[model samples]
Target: MFKAFVKIAVLLSLTASMAFGYQAIRLNVSEGTYKERNDAFNGILEVDLEDAGFTPKDIHPKIEYYYKLFYGTKLLKDGKPNPQFKTDYVGNLDNLGFITISNEEWMRELLMKEPKLGSFAPLNYLIYKKKSEDKTYVGTLTPQAMLDIAEIKDAGVRAAFTEKIDALSDATDEGMGGEVEYVEIDKLPAKTLIEWEIPFDRGEDVLDAKFDFMEKFEKAFEAEEYIIAGKRDFAEYWVDNDLENDKYDAYWVYSLCHFTFSYTVFNVWEHPELGASAPCSMYMYLDKDSSTLKVGMPSVDNWAVFGKITDPKRLQFIKDMDSKIKEIMTSLGAKEI
Candidate 1:
């Protein structure tokens, strides 16, 4: 009887999430593998979301390949191979990835009015499948929740952004089918985002100093063992695609991951579904004629809510990640704003 009650409660929570439209994470579960679904992902998403204006820029196409990485890490750490260290153990995920995507034209319209939107601009259009469940889940963080976390007070912006997310969600439904799901949390955590800005001289050439700063930024994070998994240049994207985006002189989105950190939670704890929020998105942008680079990303604290993560040690580790990111940004002369 208790088990039946628990099942009903879970169903009720998901129904509430679908009704309110703003749960911790939005998910669609389709039963099958990549090929069986005809490359529908989450549609391998070059066709659906892109056609609908959610264009992907940088993609970590296959994240489940990390088992090889784990093998190497284990070998190096232990100075010898242990029989228990299963080199072939790839965990429960059959497919997983982080695809950074954005609607450039919409962002072009909204960015100047709300740069904080960049935190989700090239949001993670995450896709993953668990072998144990024989199901694929594809979706992103909810836009309303995004607005709340970014503290966006503009009603018009909120409406438009959520509309955009809805359209993207619709595209996914066309590409993948099944019942939608959500993590049970209804309220956001106390903290939502980490944002900072650092001043830099544009100098004789805008690109020159920007490139130098980017190089330094990459190196600094690498020193702390964070993997720079992917990067996208929205400014160049507009130019190459012949889209009007003169608002920002330069703009970039970076995907960051601490390998050990991710491995511990997703692989060790066996919550592969959390791949939807893997690899943080850190956005850097400089407005036309401005001399500051603003950076922002959703806090790792949000991940705890996404996965309903309850372990105190794991929660603290997630919280510490937010602090570590802030410390790195500040060490690079960035000031929290």
Candidate 2:
């Protein structure tokens, strides 16, 4: 009986430790116009990252991705049918800044330990103005949170990821002098690896299937009333540029959106900042060793906790989206592993 009690206690402690699974790196820029501030923030990301020994691989793509989202959502809100939305709101609202940077090669190697970690790779950041506020806020989901939620158990890998994010945070605050807020969530669901696996040697069109699956996945979401905000084929770009190494062969991140759901949680709730998690990411990569294509994504549950979304409708939208992703993966012959 005592042994059983001790085991229960240990399990409870473990659960408690994982409750707060994320930290939000925040900065406030209050001096400039929304567009000026947004543009300055974009410059900040590039300068700060370069100063911190990191190189941002792409900026325009990320910015365009968000613009697509902003405009697509504007159309979705206009109640237009036939799968077309208005694009007239492009420059009407406050400008948004977005960018992506790849971690050091060593950090990428550490990712091999747990393929799911790729979801956090080419780390993305966003800077936006809230409707109720004058200051433009800059933030990113920290690497520590991604590692924790993905259940990364290697102490070394965990430390490395944390160090990388901490360094990025410091660089971001270089000249801003703003108090960076780290919102530690204390009630996150346990670490979850949302991945699917297929049976077969990878040589068999798993690569082709990756592309096909992405197409089907977008169509499926559209059929179910979702929008394809944007997508990045990281692996294709990497391989094309001869950036590929022996570690892995392919990778991609797809951004999806439900504007109606976002309207309630972001606009109605006055949590425009929550759009930081907008265009939710679904990433996939190949595991050369296992000869299996690994599909993984950080669940929407992270957004709920990190964004502090509590309304039933918002939460339900998250759950439904998660379920829908799984269903699409299954349809592609990849069973959740």
Candidate 3:
């Protein structure tokens, strides 16, 4: 009787071990082996989620989730996982970064829990199996993405403008031998998301003068002499040139507010030399669409010189050219229109 009992006990133990050790192969892939080519190839294998002891509820939410595993003798260029061993998640499992388990610990746990299954020593690989499906689509943080976020936070343009304003204040005090009284306006019309304004002096008078000039200028340029393109809010006008020596074949652009500002650029590539020339027969006017240019302390017309126009000779040349153009305009009876 004792001998028979021992045999029965051994058989039961073996059966139990076999049942617990039966693990389904979830994923398998062959990655890279080509030394000449930098690119690696991938293969994939998967098993049913239910067989892996997961429920439908767990797989429903994070369906788009993917995980990668590494394996084989080959390794990545960075000396990390072998680049050739790219494997996809099986059984609706989403990748959630790296698994916390070490290879030795994972193997030990599997063998102890399911002794019936054969040794997992042959399965040397990186496993990226999904644990749950209820996942959110939060974006990943790449280096570029982080830099972009940081740039937005820094608002470099705004900071630069603030520094300019501080310098201007210091200059005014030194030049005048007294602190000038000032009021800062935080808001202005027609400002872009990054644009702001503060009026320094006679805001009302400045605005009225510009608005009046724009009104008259718009009327003067309303003739049907130019071909208009684009919408009224933003448009371009093109005029063919007859002068042979003129580098430009056509003058194409849209002017706003009596040529005070241009929202859309005019492209005239023929005469690169004439690129900065004042309008010939052309004129621009401020319309309702250009309402953003409200009167504000004339925006320091010297801004380009103080801020960006680095070449002294080029700057003087521009001034000289402007004077010459004015003389030509006066001679031609072409008043500011």
Candidate with maximal lDDT? 1
Candidate 1 per-residue C-alpha lDDT over 212-259 given as tens digits, one digit per residue, 9 for 90 to 100:
998999999999989997787777778888988767888877888897
Candidate 3 lDDT: 0.24
What is candidate 3's lDDT per residue for 1-337, written digit by digit as tens?
5434433543564465355532111111112222211111011112221222211111111111311222223456577766535343123332211111012222222322322111111111112222232211111111111122112233443353224323322322222221121111122212111111211232355345444544443444443122121111111111122222112111111221111111111111111111111122121222222332211111111212222344676455435434443443344334432
Ranking by TM-score: 1, 2, 3
Cα lDDT tens digits, model 2, 241-300, are 666457666666666667656554554455555555555666677655566666777777
Query: What residue runs in model 3 are displaced by over 4 Å at the alpha carbon?
Result: 1-303, 335-337
Clashing pairs in 2: 20-185
lDDT of 3 at 180: 23
- TM per candidate comes to 0.83, 0.72, 0.16
Which candidate would rank higher by TM-score, 1 or 3? 1
TM-score-wise, the better of 2 and 3 is 2
Whole-structure CA lDDT of model 1: 0.76
Q: How far in Å is the alpha carbon of 24 misplaced in model 2?
A: 4.6
Q: Quote the positional error of residue 179 for candidate 3 in Å.
A: 36
Supply the global lDDT for candidate 2.
0.60
Candidate lDDT (C-alpha), each: 0.76, 0.60, 0.24
